[model samples]
Target: MPELLDPRNDFLFKRIFGSEENRDVLLTFLNRTFMEANKPLLSEIILLNPYTDKDSPTDKQSIMDVRARTTEGELINVEMQLFNRYDMEKRTLFYWSKLYTSQLVEAQSYSTLQRCVTINIVNFKLLKNEQYHNVFHLREDRTGIELTDDIEIHFLELPKLDAGSISLQQGGLANWLLFLQGATPDQWEVLTMNEPKLKKAMTTLEFLSQDREARMRYEARQKFLHDQASLMEAAKNAEIYGFKSGVEEGVKQGIEQGIEQGIEQGIQQGREEEKKQTALRLLRLGLAVSAIAEATGLSEEDVHSLSQSLE
Candidate 1:
């Protein structure tokens, strides 16, 4: 048996955008996303917390929650959504609103607000539009003026992101997506280029996917996703389980009830702190920023800053 594949592990997803050694790869990927060929890349990254345990926690599954940020003082939230729970839209709105508003404390002024990017990785399609990646932001209708480029939301649909075509090999998103979907070892050689960082990440991910224990966890998650997809399909066919309109109606009520009681219900805040400290410690041990970032939730920028502070 091979090593189990666990997508919820930050140590596993480190290939995506965590690690100083792979910083160049991350910068390259983000640069491509920015639409400017040579623009400066993000200096830091605040990785999304995968676990719900906030304080001192054990390494476990990978289910990157709704948010993380960049070291350049930018907030980046990456969410891995496996099901189309009825309140996904509203839930997203609520989380985003919380993140956006949480920037300032009671005594802090609004000027201290930071830029935020919310990236959602969903199994379901968010819109009926043609694009796989949809970005939303506030903009002036008439002049096309962005009231603030500070807050942005990026949605990536796994089902819609096709990789069989030749055109996609041009940049980082394709490469990263393939990596995320657990590309085959045979496909690894096909990803030819002198890009050492990306190659390293791909190699690392491939190696981990071979672990039997990891593969078991990954298979379990895959099965869960399959089950959810089937449920949605059955409901679409007017099946009994899908006819629960009352459940949908009660979702908002339940969420409201939870919120009314001041229950945030996730360890995002605590996880962020833990990841930050872990990143700093790893950096002190002379580990690569990308690796450290992936292992912890700190961004390359944050790690670099912490690394410098220690000097």
Candidate 2:
């Protein structure tokens, strides 16, 4: 069955902010989170690349990209982090610095640099001391003086939040965060006291979550995420296998590909290579041509040729 509320599920995430309309909805929600005055706020907030190392050729390097800037001149970068890589903190700082620096052109002064906010939705805890959802702003360490208002960082640890304890009136953003992290088939009735816009937001989320098309979209996203994770794992495995006195994994991948071609030549080559490799002990065990052919999805003659070649 398709999952209803997994952020890793692409469909659900897209349903949240994938399209222009949905993005509009989310932008509105984010604005409300700030308690911004009811004026025309953010006009356009575009999603850019989310991964830290954009230039890296490795498939494992690229991650889900989600960054945007508001119309009223506020920048927001949101990332959905699954694993706690050692460099996450550093990478976030680097991105923030890069974004901050990119604002100033050859002639523009640093004073013109607008305020930017980054929200990281990490599945794992980030800071060691602060356990709850935390927001960081620049301030003087000794005298508690405000350094600058141009930057803000908010970190939400999904596993650390509890929806029941959060108040609808006092904790608006907190409620929203809880809703996002809440389990599937959540009791919507308990959340009726939220702000009007948040009520609308929940309605939207509920409608999208229940829709069949939305379900399919979420399934497709899950598949994509799964494929990406698999690719990264495969690359890591390849690198590891390359390092150790072992080419067995590489040879195994190649032979598996060959065997999938159901043709005589392909099967013969696959079996011959497999049989000779001491690493593949199962292949070394003698078996009838028909038996080998059946097991590997190769024809009997092809298996016989492979057996002969191996001898």
Candidate 3:
């Protein structure tokens, strides 16, 4: 028996939880996520884009998310993201906007827009907080008052789950996330007992894992994910390196030119402090406003402002 497939692989996820055949799995998972968050549990859900054989990873164009609609007309999108897309927040907003706006075709009232909820089950960490689950909504920044319930987004950061702490305290959400995180055999038994449909979900993974062609596609998908993560990390490192180099070069050039012009205090007293010290000294030296601006890398307006006081 081959090892069970990981549910976090979006393709495998769609296989187990995105099809009408496994609508129970998707319902339980969504219910657990909402229940744990103290949000309303969905009595029933309809998959707007149910899965089919063409969803296999062999087809590069397969949709990666499980889109559904609650019985109450609320739009829900559940996506399994195995990499930290740095733009997750903005990406979520874009989708939420699309779903919310797509509700009204033409001449429809603004009140016709149904609530759009985007639930992202992400493998890597994105939020700074320790909680594995974070829900966001438009609210007053300081007063903490929600302006509307029209747009809701959930970010389930898998990395933030503390393995030691989640015995059963949070219940179904923890179990489902653990299943996605790859539960051990013993843990799998406990989880299945906790959620009846989970056993079927596990069975789906087992069946997929043993099939030769399915195994091949899963492997290919895993390789693609690994390559994608590597590319994102490399790009992030390059961006950071470029930023530091630019800052160092700019500061070094300004300091070198200041020192060469015989300004005694080229020692940076921090950026703003350094600017003030250099500007004051150049001002005291009776240099022209333009000359001081050139020496300190400040605009003429800035030099004039610095020349006024605090010398």
Candidate 4:
């Protein structure tokens, strides 16, 4: 095994858990996931879009996720996201709606629509909680009554998975997530021993890791993911810097303008106060109010008020 491929890298994830030969692998993972969520488990999952050599990086529309249907006819889409686009909430809703609505066709009754579930395995932290997995559905706000069972969404933020705290006795989901996170050979040996189904997933990864062509495609996909992450990160950093610079510049200009206005008002007020004092002195010396008003540049009303203050 030449450095086992990371299953979180969507392409390798398809090879490990989305291939027809690895159907059991996907089934086990799904069961574990549902068990953790306290939802009903599936007996079998039919893979509609399995991995193929023709799944090129250029033709990605169909090969983007592991599309499956359960024996109960519920549609399920599982995707591995290597980077956070910062729109996971709305993006997940958009994709879920697409999947839910895609089930209907022209002249088809709304009754024909099956329950659709979307599982997003994101590499970055998505939820504020420390828990690694969460599920959502349409429900009444005050009452806990569910509108329907036709829509379901799950988010498994891999970065929040606590490897040390995971106990195989508790569940197999933790083990499966760790395997996807690219567990070391030694770690897999222990994890696989506890979860028998993970053996196939590990074996698939090992077989695919050494294939020269697969490695080439994997590297291409890896490069694209990394480049996309870098580009998004650069854009986010630039936006923050731009906002900070704009705020600082605005504050600096506002402070300077405020100081200038304050100084101008102070000078005007001081000149007016001097005029009032001169008018008072001249008035007390028996000069007429009109002459004092003219000499001091004070309005007649102002001079009158000063004279009243004197009296």
Candidate 5:
């Protein structure tokens, strides 16, 4: 038997549930996902960025996420992320803000903005909890009062899903998550027997996996994504190492300069100058202002001022 393609590949993911013909499959999956999270079920959705098969193999620059608008005008964006970038929290909030604000024209009021939901299917674990499915909302800390139902984010950690314990008969969202994680042929057979929508999804996956052109495109996209992930990891490592080196140098310089100056005021000035220099170096390295401030022991406001001056 031929090996099945990983449905978590964003390209294949889009082809599976981002097309007009597969709207029902997407609808069922969304409803099940929301219900599992204890949210209202979606009755209807209109795909904003419908999937289209590429004529040639392309890089990962192509946007393959599915964007939809519900019957109530709530926006939903779903994307399969294969790598953990360590910035998903901030990235999700940024994208959610854009989606929520993009609904209105110039004269529209804030009341016209609708809720925006982001569903990220990550191949790696994100939360510290043992649960595979994690949901977020804007709620008060002490009283647990929701500020509004406008912001919703769900993370489905594929690695956290227990394949052995997942039952097709009972696992509503688990069935879909397992399928996306590339269930074996035997598993697919069993899953299809229990979930009708999943059967349709499996058919689409098999069809796309077997197509010569589609396979090439998928391979190309996968390669591009891997390359991007590798680059990001390298950059993160470099930033960490550089920060450590800077801190060490700053401490060494502070001690040496203080000893050489041999006066209370001189020592204070020396340490201050060293810290400022370290902060400047970190800023030049493109570290975030908060990170630079934390590393250099400078106030966030000072770091921001330094960053602006450098720019």
Candidate 6:
């Protein structure tokens, strides 16, 4: 058996579900997801951003989201996210808002806008609850009254899914989620035996996994995703560190400025006494000797002497 590529990879995911050739596969997956959630099923869909082969180097970095419109004119955005940057909640809302607002043209009435749904298949757990699948909508908090049916968001956390509990014989959303979570060949064979849509998807995955050119593209896409995740993590850490450092520095400067003002108002002996007291207080606050020196206008040696005298 050829090594199978991870369907969670955005590149392979778009090719599997967003391709025009496998429209039925996309339809089946969407219907299963909706039906499992007790929501209205999509009968027909028109792919908006259909998958196209990336032939050139520039084309290899194309956006890998699948945008479609249902027969009811409802827009659906499906995308697989392999890593959690801790901003999915806000990002989902931002994208959903854009999609909803973009539907209306200049001077077009609000009634012209259609319902927009975003389906996010995430590899990592997002919500605090144990449930793997979560759906959200605009609803009143006190009375459970739905404000509008215009917006919807679904998060399918693959890491939280229990494949062992899912029965392939039922052939519902669980089976599809399992398939995307990289089930083994034997498991795929069993799943495909029961689910025809899954069988078709498995065939496509196999073909793509085996093709040398497709594998190369998949590897390149995987590397790009890894590099992007690393960069995002680094950026987030830097932001947090910068915020904390700025706050500490601001507080220290504020204390130093107030002490300097007092020193300017008093005699030289009083100023030296104030400096010693300030240094002692900073030392008690666990500030470093160098920081106390900088804040108190005293040399490091004087700060050290003050610290010893306090001890």
For candidate 1, lDDT tens digit of each residue in 1-311? 35435443333344334444455555555654554223346765544443322312122333334344666677766666766755666777777777888888899998888887666766667778857677778899999888997777777766776786635346456565555565665666555442345676665556657766545545555666567668766766675545676688689799888886654435666677778777777777889978887777667788888888888
Regions more than 4 Å wrong, model 2: 1-3, 8-11, 32-66, 168-171, 203-217, 223-311
The better candidate by TM-score, 2 or 6, is 6
Residue lDDT tens for model 5, 168-279: 7775899898888878777877776667789899988888878887888889988878888999999999999999999999999999998777787777888988999999
Pick by TM-score: which candidate is best?
4
Instruction: Look at candidate 6 and give me any clashing residue pairs.
Output: none
Against the unseen true structure, what C-alpha lDDT does each candidate score? 0.61, 0.61, 0.84, 0.87, 0.87, 0.88
For candidate 5, what is the total of clashing residue pairs? 0
Candidate 2 overall Cα lDDT vs. reference?
0.61
Off by over 4 Å in 1: 1-29, 36-40, 46-63, 66-68, 192-195, 216-311
Better of 5 and 6 by lDDT: 6
In terms of lDDT, the poorest run of 10 residues in model 1 is: 51-60
What's model 6's TM-score? 0.79
Report the C-alpha displacement of residue 80, candidate 1, in angstroms: 2.1
The TM-score, computed over Cα atoms with residue i paired to residue i, of candidate 2 is 0.56
> What C-alpha RMSD separates each model from the true structure?
32.6, 19.1, 11.3, 2.9, 17.9, 12.0
TM-score leaderboard ranking: 4, 5, 6, 3, 1, 2
**Backbone clash numbers for all candidates listed:** 29, 4, 0, 0, 0, 0
Across 1-311, the per-residue lDDT of candidate 4 in tens digits comes to 48766778888788878889889989999998999899999998899989888887544463768999998889999999989988889988898888889888999999999999999999999898998999999999999899999989999988898888878565478988988777887887788776888888877778888999888889888887888789889999999999999999999999999999999999999999999999999988999989988899999899999999988
| Cα lDDT tens digits for candidate 6, 1-311 | 57999999988998899999998999999998898789988889999988887532124343788899999899999989998878999988888888899998899899999999899999998999988888999999999999998888999999998877877787888888898988987887777766788988888999999999889988888887888889899999999999999999999999999899878767788889999998898899999999889998999999988778876
Q: How do the residues 1-311 of candidate 2 rate in per-residue lDDT, one tens digit apiece? A: 33445543323444465444566656755665455323235556765543232222223433344567766566777666665554677888887887788878999887888888776777767787545566778999999788997778767777776665666566355666655665344454455455445565566667766777656655655665567667777777777877773577677877887777657787788776775442223346865656666666656676666566667
**Model 4 CA RMSD to the hidden true structure, in angstroms:** 2.9
Better of 1 and 2 by TM-score: 1
Work out candidate 6's RMSD over C-alphas: 12.0
Using lDDT as the yardstick, the better of models 3 and 5 is 5
Model 6: how far is 173 from its true place, Å?
Answer: 1.0
TM-score of 4: 0.86
Superior by lDDT: candidate 3 or candidate 4: 4
RMSD of 2: 19.1
